[model samples]
Target: MFRQMFEEKYMRFPGGRAKAATFSYDDGVKADKRLAEIFAKYGIKGTFNLNSLLFDCERWHGRMDEEQTFLTFYNRPHEIAMHGARHIFLNKVPLPEAMNEILQNRVYLENRFGRIVRGLAYAYNGYNAEVLAALPALGVAYGRTTEDTRTFALPEDFLRWNPTCHHTDPALFEIAEEFVKRDPAGEFKHREPLLFFVWGHSYEFDDADNWQVCEKLCARLAESEGIWYATCIEICDYVKAYRSLIFSADGERVYNPSAIPVWLELRGRIYELPPATTVQFAKEL
Candidate 1:
């Protein structure tokens, strides 16, 4: 029985980490600079959503000039994602308008950052089925929503991905405590990869005068031994690569066709499969 358990095969995150935690913040507001600093202090990774049209736009408080600041202050480890060109409500708009919002913003962000912009967090978390369907063709791989699941499981559909919780979720501390207490090495019925995805707008911290909420959350989640701290796109790309792996008819050999390497847990050991490479494993009975 011990040998059989050792022979069991499953996908593991990079570095053999048992879980991942990522953050998503929307709107390219000035407050994001401070938020980014906080995240950096805690070694947290996140994706920042920006509306190309909103850059340098004046708000009731003052002009934000995010176009210049984003290029200067945003950390390289984090990602820049689209939040629509005009920050319009997609669910309320015509399909063409919605498409234009996403496509135009994607083009601008790609050109500005010199990185392929493939992730989106809906403006106002306002998207319908049509909006979701239009994303893939626009080169978007995942779209995050505002719906809070308050659980640590990976999303079934990336386009409609719901986060584990919002930063302000009344149960935020409680959930974080539970997440930290989970012992991945111990036997559990659910052996799938765990993800704690937190999403919110950086401006909210300024509004509520509660930056400490984020500070405490990050401090608690930082330096977790078995957790992978990653951006949304990084997590999505890795999972996609893992899912694209091919196995032989007898399941003794596996081929990785993706450009990114994939990790597999077999018999209590982690193995790395290089890109465009094949790995053969001993069959277990």
Candidate 2:
């Protein structure tokens, strides 16, 4: 018999999906236009981390203009996150300087896009403990780092969010293959929602002459029916909502307090827990 009482309670993505995939591309560059097209073609969503000061800065031909940014991402199934106001290394500067960099970028993006900007991809993957602690007060919700963990695991800390791998990792397709085949319910030994997060700069494809990397990855993920394509912010928000669920002492009922709907797995059975509603399970622990 299954050890239902001892089994860990797991969660699923929207629509009761066990697997979810998200991409993060840094820098608002000319190549992002092509990258956005590839994502759109595959019906995938991702986040673009941009440095507002770099727009039309003319330091190089690759920098995108405000109009280019809007045309590529506006009204699209994607997100815009901060990469610092000037794309400087946050760890090297004073704490206030680092904060200003993020705040200026957030303000510009919010004013331009007419939406609250709260996510970040560190400029140069640099940050200190103080800067991380300062993010939430700055209205930031999650931050992405360049450290590639090479595993399908949810982050322990959203402020220091580490992705599964970079797009250019040699094991990119191998990892995607593993992600596509795994059935979360079947893995009784380890049952948790899987997140395949990939992070990179769009201009790297142009520099390395490897645009096929993005195309191939997108096509592979798009073919999978079980994977939920989501933006970085959406994933963070959903995870928060899932963690906010209140449970009864007997573990037979749960209430989702957040506005987002959640899917809970109890003893291998999946249950849809709607926002602000309580769900009672047939079996008690």
Candidate 3:
């Protein structure tokens, strides 16, 4: 029911349409040192997805440069989150194994970093419906996947069925359809998040051919309107804040944020949410 309603309300663009992009990386390797250095040099906040057990201060893949920066990365507070224990794909394994994989990594991080990590990215690019539905219970707020099907992703719970009715990245077939629709003979509308999410190995840059593609891609990703490069935790906060103002009703949906009554003040009379909620506080287009 919610998905149906979600599909109805947001199938069209809100207007001239707001835009955004999020760039992220996967697997913790020494290459990450250069990645972080480059991003930090440019003030671009790259989301570095990591596995808790991978950083061992030992050598692997030719270099003796295993990092102990798990302490630094997880503790930095900008962006990072769980990437499944041992980078295993939950969908490829049984439920208990999958859950344990995620949990072991999570606990490992918390124990080392002294704080909770509530985001995830399944390893091996594998995921199933059940793994998703179980996230809320496992202490994950959100996680990342490797799909780049060209769509602005909205969480399932927010759509009418979830609420936003945001369509999944229309992948191969949809891309073809969108191409036909846009020019009827031209190219796809690129109705996707302009901030295309791309990720893969750092060593890929080591190859002459692969490095050429990566060079052109990163060079062109610069956005003049400004791009807020962020990590997994930072992204989770934005999502939570955005969702706090959106809700669903019936098959039709409305953003009656102001209608939801709530106390205006929490602590020393500073924090508050007035009874008559309005879209005034919502993120602007």
Candidate 4:
């Protein structure tokens, strides 16, 4: 039973033990472009959460039309999703106002980018159950929250495991290399090794300490062949796929994604997948 839950927690859509780590860049534009370029070089894909209002700020930033154009260009490989209109905290505002932020932004983004915005990252990761219920009506299949207590967040249901924005944690990043190479054996022993989710603003890649830590962690993730690097969207779909398959092969399933988190056994622990599955990390062009 524990193994079943463990496999369920880490299982991706289709069903497999593979771990994936996603690289997401929020706010949009040049930094978005740079992050895409870097990930592309490594054959990885990412999710770009955009705030529609800020696109107009290109002119204000002294770029004079460069902002929107730059974002339009970089948006090619990444999935362009809504990032709330004003970055407002949903808990503080009235429901209509908060829902409008998501609905309006999805409209503006579709008009500009021509893609259906299905995923969202709550500004500041603040939300209540009421907010979640409203998303489906607004055409959002899933959204992420600001939770990273573990390497990954499991679904309360298979339909949702959207880790909105993975907070940047320096502690893990600082020792990733040392931990992966040596610790995976003893100090870092877990039946199913982690698929680390480290995130931060792409523009801040210039920060000396932050950059080094991000670089170090990325290197470790790359070196560790067991884990899969994936974006939150990819994770959601994968989890959804996994659950649906278990319930039915045709992809019709009613279940939560977090019912499974990890499995511990005499061998210690390891990830488990359902009957059939392979979580893909590439993006649509």
lDDT of each: 0.83, 0.88, 0.48, 0.55
Report the lDDT tens digits of candidate 2 across residue range 1-285: 134455468888998888999999988889888988898899998899988887875556488998988787787778999999999999999999999999999999999888888999998889989998888989999999999999999998999899999988989999999999887767757678899999988888988999988888898889887899999999999999998999999777898999978998777677889889999886754
lDDT of 4 by residue, 127-186 (tens): 788887777889886776556544444565522344423435545654354334532323
Of the pair 3 and 4, which is ahead by lDDT?
4
Worst 10 residues of 1 by lDDT: 1-10
The TM-score obtained by model 2 is 0.95
lDDT of 2 at 221: 87
Alpha-carbon lDDT of model 2: 0.88
lDDT over C-alpha atoms for residue 106 of model 1 = 93
What TM-scores do the predictions have? 0.92, 0.95, 0.61, 0.68
Q: Which stretches of candidate 1 lie over 4 Å from their true place?
A: 1-8, 58-63, 72-75, 283-285
lDDT of 1 by residue, 85-192 (tens): 988998998899899989999998888777788999987789888887888899999999999999987877899889999988999999998888785545444556
State candidate 4's TM-score: 0.68
Query: In model 3, what is the error at residue 57, expressed in angstroms?
Result: 9.3
Q: How far is each candidate from the true structure, as Cα RMSD in Å?
A: 2.4, 2.0, 9.8, 8.3
User: In candidate 4, where is summed lDDT lowest over 10 consecutive residues?
Assistant: 1-10
